[model samples]
Target: MPAEKKAYPLRISATVLEAMQRWSDDELRSVNAQIEYVLREALRKSGRLKAGMAKPMVDDKPDT
Candidate 1:
């Protein structure tokens, strides 16, 4: 079975969004992807992401 995705509404100021775009491009990722990646990493580092938590949109790629 495939997983489903849920969309959320996010609001950002223009200046903050511009900075996010610049950093996202520098990191070779879309703004959304960069944000998801960072959040996931922080959760993992903080031990908040356990082995059986609800799946999120981050790193849905297959192992290569």
Candidate 2:
């Protein structure tokens, strides 16, 4: 079975949102996924991604 999706609320700058939308479009990912990717990368860079924690899988399809 496929994994269920979860919703998160976040606040970002207008420029950041615009950049994310572009990035997500280029990468064939949703805006939310792009944001999550950036957040996870930041967390990992700061040594916050635990070995035992599951990684996220973003769907290629955008929100309906």
Candidate 3:
């Protein structure tokens, strides 16, 4: 089963939001997803999140 997601309000600069939008578009991901992906990577890199604890960014196969 997919994990549950929580809604949180975020305040960001317009400049940063624009950049993230472009990056997310380029990667074919929603801005929210891109942000989470970045945060997850950063956490893993900093040893705050375990490697095995991170969820896969994409599924191996399409669900039918």
- Model number with the top TM-score: 3
lDDT, each prediction: 0.72, 0.76, 0.80
The better candidate by lDDT, 1 or 2, is: 2
Best lDDT among the predictions, by candidate number:
3
Model 2, 1-64: lDDT tens digits are 5557778678889998999999999877888877877777788778888743436664566556
Q: Which lDDT tens digits does candidate 1 get at residues 1-64?
A: 5456567888989998898889887877788877777777788879998745535555543454
Off by over 4 Å in 1: 1-3, 51-64
**Worst 10-residue lDDT window, candidate 2:** 51-60
| Candidates 1 and 2, the one with greater TM-score | 2
lDDT of 3 by residue, 1-64 (tens): 6666788999999999999999987877778888888889899889999878787555333344
Cα RMSD for predicted model 1? 3.8
Error of 3 at 3 (Å): 1.8
Residue pairs with backbone overlap in model 2: none
Clashes of each: 0, 0, 0
Q: What is residue 16's positional error in candidate 1, in angstroms?
A: 2.3
- What TM-score quantifies how close candidate 2 is to the native fold? 0.69
| Rank by TM-score (best first) | 3, 2, 1
